[model samples]
Target: MNKPDVSYSIFQDWRANRGNIKAQFILSLFRLATWVRSNKILIILFIWYLPFYRFFVEWVMGIELPWSLKAGRGLKLQHGQALVVHGQTIIGSNCGLKHSTTIGIRMNPDGSVGRAPIIGNNVDIGAHVCIIGAIEIGDNVAIGAGSIVVKSIPPNCVVVGNPARVVKVNEPVTSSYS
Candidate 1:
């Protein structure tokens, strides 16, 4: 929602509730990258990720996270592997992204690049989930694993299956963090 609180320290959040080893590693790298972006004086620190960035993206983490992806505060990576999010994607606060999840873009009929998905606050995306196109996943939505989401989803719903149909609605919004 309202800019999703970017004041908190990502390093502290990772130290407080490090979900898994892979999550810790990825978050650490992401935090370092974010910090480097803010303070240009510390640009030398980016050299640490340059060599391993491709390896982590393709082999280890299996993610395609770019510096342009706008993520809110309290972002959590559950298993932290195979998560592909486009550069134009906007992820909300306290969102949990599991392994093998993809939030990518598609091409428009005019042969131009389409918009990526916009995920709202407190959204829990499960493993092996694919969210494509310019869909808007609303706040508090929980998508089950292996679901392929091609359409926009409303808030406070639980979606599952190949086409990601809403199985339940009006559920409580819960976060993985304490």
Candidate 2:
């Protein structure tokens, strides 16, 4: 038997590693919405998700991710509920977000609305983590449960606690998840 191509194998691996079932469903809907919004031909089909968007956002998945939010490939939602991400926020590939995690905006000192957080690749965000403001979370970083992050985090660090302090640095990214 002939072996599969490298690109096909990589795609299969990505599909296999797409977190839980809930995450897969929500991500599918998000991708559909994004595609519908982008293609002028599918503009008429947007009505399917328009009326039910609030219901899906508030009740079903508890996620408020809009089509404008730029989420990269291999995004994982641990619990896939009560997770709020700002429309302007940018998330990198293979990032895992747990329940009740909010990545939103904050008010600046000049009374202006600040930008949302930019999450890096392979970052694991624990449950109830609130990453606010215009901070940039670096790659291969892990934010512990219930962390209130307001500042930019460097790469390969583990941050925890409220107002999030870096507890560990130069840590390796582990692929195992329970």
Model 1 agreement with the true structure over 28-120: per-residue lDDT tens digits? 566555555555565575666645755666567677777567887678887666678887999997888888888999999999999999999
Best by lDDT: 2
How high is each candidate's TM-score? 0.80, 0.82
Per residue, candidate 2 scores C-alpha lDDT tens digits across 82-128 of 88889899999878888888899999889999988999988999999
Residue 100 in model 1: lDDT:
83
Model 1 off-target regions past 4 Å? 1-7, 12-19, 38-52, 57-60, 171-178
Best by TM-score: 2
**What RMSD does each model have against the real structure?**
4.7, 6.2
Looking at candidate 2, the ten consecutive residues that score lowest on lDDT are 1-10
Error of 1 at 79 (Å): 2.0
